[model samples]
Target: MPEDARKRARRRLSIARGHLDSIVRMLDDPEVYCVDVLRQIKAVQGALSGAGDVVLRGHLEAHVATSAGRGDSVELVEEVMEALRYR
Candidate 1:
C-alpha cells in the first residue's frame, strides 16, 4: 500500500475503534438513549467503510493495475470480486 493511503486508513480505523469503545461504554449506561447509540454505531460503520475504500483503491493501484500485463490477474481479480461481493 502507498504510505499516504495506509496512513489514512489507519487514522480512520483508529477513529472507528474509539467510536466502538464509546458505544460499548454507552451500552453499559442504563440512561443512554437507544437512538443515540444507534447513531454512533452508524458513524463507526461509515468510518470503517471509508477505510475500506482506501484499502480497495490501494489494491487497485498497486496490485490489479500492474497484474494485468503480467497475465496473472485471475486470482487477483477473483479476490477483488469477493471483496466487492461482501462489501
Candidate 2:
C-alpha cells in the first residue's frame, strides 16, 4: 500500500478504536442513553468503511490499473469482486 493511504487508514482505525472503547464504557453505565451508544456504533462502522475504501482505492491505483499488462486481469477482477461483496 502507498504510505499515505496506509497512514490515513490507520488513523481512521484509531478513531474507531477510541469510539469502541467509549461504547464499552457506556455499556457499563446503567444511565447511558441507548441512542448515544448507537451513535458511537455508527461512528465505528463508518471508520471501518473508510478504512476499507482507502485500501480498495490504493489497490485499484497500484495493481488493478496495471493488471492487463501483467496478464492477471481475470484473477485480479475476481479478487476485487470478492473483497467488495459485502458492500
Candidate 3:
C-alpha cells in the first residue's frame, strides 16, 4: 500500500479501536443507557467500515491493477469479491 493510504487506514483503525474500548467501558458502567451504548457500537462499526473501504481502495489501486499484467488479477479480484460477500 502507498504510504499515505496506509497511514489513513491506520488512523481509522485506531479510531475504531478507541471506540471499541469505550464500548467495553460502557458495558461495565451500570449507569450507561442501552440506547447510548448501542449508538457507540454503531459508531465503532462505521469507523471499522471506513477502514475496510480504505484498505480495499488501496488494494485495488496498488495491487490488483498492477497484477493485471502479471496474469493474477482475476484471482485477486475473485478473492476480494468473496471476502466482501462473506463480510
lDDT of each: 0.93, 0.93, 0.87
- Give the Å error, residue 59, model 1: 0.4
> Which pairs, if any, clash in model 2?
none
Better of 1 and 2 by lDDT: 1
Q: Considering TM-score, which of the candidate structures 1 and 2 is the better prediction for this target?
A: 2
TM-score of each: 0.88, 0.93, 0.84
Judging by lDDT against the true structure, name the best candidate: 1
lDDT of 2 by residue, 1-87 (tens): 788889998999999999999999999999999999999999999999998899889888888999999999999999889978865
Q: Which tens-of-lDDT digit does each residue in 1-87 have in candidate 1? A: 888899999999999999999999999999999999999999999999999999989888888899978888999989889879766
Model 3: how far is 37 from its true place, Å?
0.2
Q: Model 1, residue 62: what's the lDDT?
A: 85
Tens-digit per-residue lDDT, 3-77, candidate 3: 888999999989999999999999999999999999999999999889888887887788787887988978998
Better of 2 and 3 by lDDT: 2
Clash total of candidate 2 = 0
Model 2 stretches with alpha carbons more than 4 Å out = none
Q: Give Cα distance to truth, residue 73, candidate 2, Å.
A: 1.0
